[model samples]
Target: MKKLLLFVIVFSVLSAATVTFWAHQPIIGMEEKPIEFSIKAGSGVRSSVEQIASAGVPVNPTLLGFLARLSGKSGRLKAGNYELKPGTTPLALIDQLARGEFAQEALVIIEGWTFRQMRQAVASHPALKHDTAALSDQELLAKINPQYGKPEGLFFPDTYLFAKGASDLQVYKQAHSLLQKRLNEAWGRRDPSLPYKSSYEALIMASIVEKETGQKSERNMIAAVFINRLKRGMLLQTDPTVIYGMGDAFKGNIRKRDLETDTPYNTYTRAGLPPTPIALPGAESLEAALNPAKTDALYFVSRGNGTSVFSSNLNDHNRAVNKYQR
Candidate 1:
């Protein structure tokens, strides 16, 4: 009777040790580099175990399956791409899978970028599921939000994180929603004396401000210039709007003829704000547009450097232009 009890104890200890060894040992051939492993949605633990075994890992599927069940992780494995790096034990991998620790991918939308550029960036990301590539701008917008009248400047400029195989439409929806939320918040806190009739108009002004300067400190000043011009019934005469109006016809340089040419976005020709936003504006630009600096300056010219010189009149603006531009 004592011999039988000793034998059982020894066997149990050996079994526990074996399971520990299997759990701690890293997979074969993946000791030096990371391997991308995927578990499909709705896949059972048995299939996942089989996949690991097939990948040349020296794991006993039956044993691994039993261990997974014992650990209460059999039904908790998530479906997504995972990087099984060197030194990742079988047990660690299982834990990662159970916790839905997927490899995150990032998509960044830069400020001042056009919607077309945003679309191109989305299409170029290899990790994203590309459903919008074949869709037209209108079709894409409809998919993202049916109520959206236009796609331009609707998406917020920020870095969005997603798990692998995430749809482009999902990213677009996130950005669009964020933009709406931010726009509403900015609109609610906007200056009462601002000339913008609606949040959309403020968004348009924000986009203009975003394109006007890269200097963070200058955004409020630039917004003030545009706001002052709008209140005084002065033509915006902004070159960015004219350049946007030129579209494909715009070469690298803006000639005198180009400035004189008329289009819907040509603030020099049109009296008020453009029909739509010219580019995607960041949060700072949006805030600047809503709360402009208190300045009488109406005109500005780029000083050839990143900064610009603000002027109260055309004479000062032309002088700054001649000094910097020439």
Candidate 2:
């Protein structure tokens, strides 16, 4: 009976050793990698030391289980993109997942995106899930209002980093907070001679500038034309605002009828700044609006070659418009 018991003990020890060795063998022909990434849909796969060993990967499930038990961490796996390495032990991978080391992704918001456009861009991201289409502008404004007073032109445009499964609200809050900080700083340093009554008005002007020109160097000139219009109480007559009012139904081009169509956002029909900004403005646009060049320009018409002709009077503007537009 004693001999049989000794043999049983040896057999059990040998079995455990074999399992340990099998679990830790490097995968044959698998080159060393700095990080390993896996893309799995639905739900991630459940991995164990024995399972990995049986599948022929160099991983030690027993060691992972032992360490997890020792560290008082069991059944704590998080789902998301992950970066791991072959050099990483099974215990390390387990610990990494348990500690929630999920990969991150980034999204960049451009200078002149409207709230609707921003929502669409965010909704299209694979990692983020939200029904932005169902939410009305009012609902979106309300949701973002706690952080941004007017939602329009309130969020700063910039590249932001986010973990996988990040919420749309989270992204908005972050953008809003960053915008508040940057706008406040810029507003404090604005040119003293700017005609705006408040920083909000400056932001509204910036949004117009942002929509009017993509050329960074031309922002100040565009802003100057708007300021000139404001000083003379001339209508802004900007076409971008008309397009904005039409919303998504705005078929890709601007037409003469569309410009004449009455809408609250149509700067041609409405006097002074619109009730709200047309889109989110970036720092450069904001600065340009606040510090427009000293010029007598009162009118501008796009020359159709990615440039606009500026004029101090309507006749000059019309001549340039006829020359370039026609």
Candidate 3:
């Protein structure tokens, strides 16, 4: 009886060792490129193993199953798309699955993009489970947050990561939350003399500043120009606001007639900031709006490049327009 028991123990040990070695071997004929394999959610170990094998990986399902059961990993497999590359072993793949490491997908929201553009981006991502595509703008805003009457510039502009099958609402919620956090932090650190009545007003100004200049160094200066105009109760006379107010009616260019047209968002005609933000503002623009440079400059004009020329009086600004814009 003792001899028979010893034989059984030796055979079991050898069997486990052989299985471990088999699991560690690199799959043959796998090319030097990565291949994507998907395990459906709620898939069992057997089904998952079969799916991996179907992806041209030479894995022994039965032995893998036995090893998984023995190692107490039979029921711990996570389901998602995984990239199987050359030199990847069955053991490594199994370990990855057990740790629930699903592939992440990235979606980027560009700064200065309108909410309409942001919506288009979210609706176009293939990996996301979209729930807002069919909804109208108002309905979508209601779904995201009821307090928000419109969806123009509410979401923060940045790259967001999500697991496969994540809903569009989930992405929007994260962006909205991050925007709120950033806005609050910036508002708390703002210069006390800023003319903004609330954080929302600062966000509106930030959006204008974001759209007005592409140069990072000019942001504070541009903010200061707008601040000076606001303090003097003068017209902002910004062309971007006039373009925004025109909406789809705005052609490729702005004309004198367009600037003279009265609209709530037409800063050339209207007195104060627009009703809401015209585009998404980045962190730097937000900071610049809250902490404008101390300057007497009340106007700025693009120098036909990525930079702007600021002037303290109208004469210099008109001459700059003729020198650069002309």
Candidate 4:
């Protein structure tokens, strides 16, 4: 019985000593990572473990196997983009994955963005990559392949979450899908008296509404002004559409010449809705377009602030424009 007790003590001491040695060996592959190196999504522990061992850090894979078995672990690894600090042990890293500790990237899509703007935002991200800007607008439009016209007015204005190595196309597709669903839902519930002939027309007006006003309270009222003009068969005369027609060369401001330009998108010349949406519209703009406030307003001008003053006739509109813009 005494010999048995002595054997147990020696075995326990050896086990503790072994654990201590491994614990102090400097966690594998963590030697050079003082600056927090990221483990991109889809990377596995094997590569990281190898990197650690090559950095002169000893790894006890047998011990890992033992602990894994004891914990009933069935290769439970967290699937996400991870960033780890220097001197992190393989055991510690595995524990993090097991607990599903991963990083989330915030992606914000603002209102009034063209599809190109949305594409550029995703392409320029540091953790993701895409040849979005390299592709022409036509080519990017083809990638999304909306049932409607081009991808304009087809991205939701909201924040999205992307993990490491997420594709730009993936995020764009998500926003596009959401936009389509929301627009379709709103179109189905449109007021029968709204001047829109179809969902497409509603989308066009919504895009104009998105560009025309940023004030939440003014959207429906501004929409009413445009709807009244449409019903009267007068030209939309939206300046933002003309700016969109100018495309890449449209510096920061619009000139008198740009307004008179004979482009399909120049509502000042075209006398009706633009050939396509000038920008992506959000849910508020879509709702406002579908169910505009009932008003006799046939014209509107920027209030020089973030809002627009609505008018019922050309004379009143010109007067408001002179008062505010001039």
RMSD (Å) of each candidate, 1 decimal: 2.4, 6.1, 2.3, 4.9
The superposed Cα distance between candidate 2 and the true structure at residue 81, in angstroms, equals 6.2
Q: Write the per-residue lDDT of candidate 4 for residues 138-215, one digit (tens) a residue.
A: 677678864655777767888888766677777877887888798899999999887777788888899999998868
lDDT of each: 0.89, 0.75, 0.88, 0.75
Off by over 4 Å in 2: 1-58, 64-81, 85-101, 131-134, 146-150
Q: Across residues 1-326, which tens digit of lDDT does each residue of candidate 3 receive?
A: 99999999999999988988887887554666766778888889889888877876567877767767777888998888777768877777778789877668899999999999999999999999998889898898897788878887788999999877888999998998899899999999999998888899999999999999869999999999999999999989888888988999987999999988899999987898999999999999999999999999998888777988999999999999999999
Q: lDDT per residue, candidate 2, 121-233, as tens digits?
A: 88788776464546776677677675444567778899888766667778887888887787778789888877789877888898999999957888999999989888888
Clash count of each predicted structure: 0, 3, 0, 2
TM-score, candidate number 1: 0.90
Q: What's the TM-score of each model vs. the native?
A: 0.90, 0.72, 0.90, 0.76
Q: What's the C-alpha lDDT at position 210 in model 1?
A: 97
lDDT of candidate 2 at residue 240, scale 0 to 100 = 85
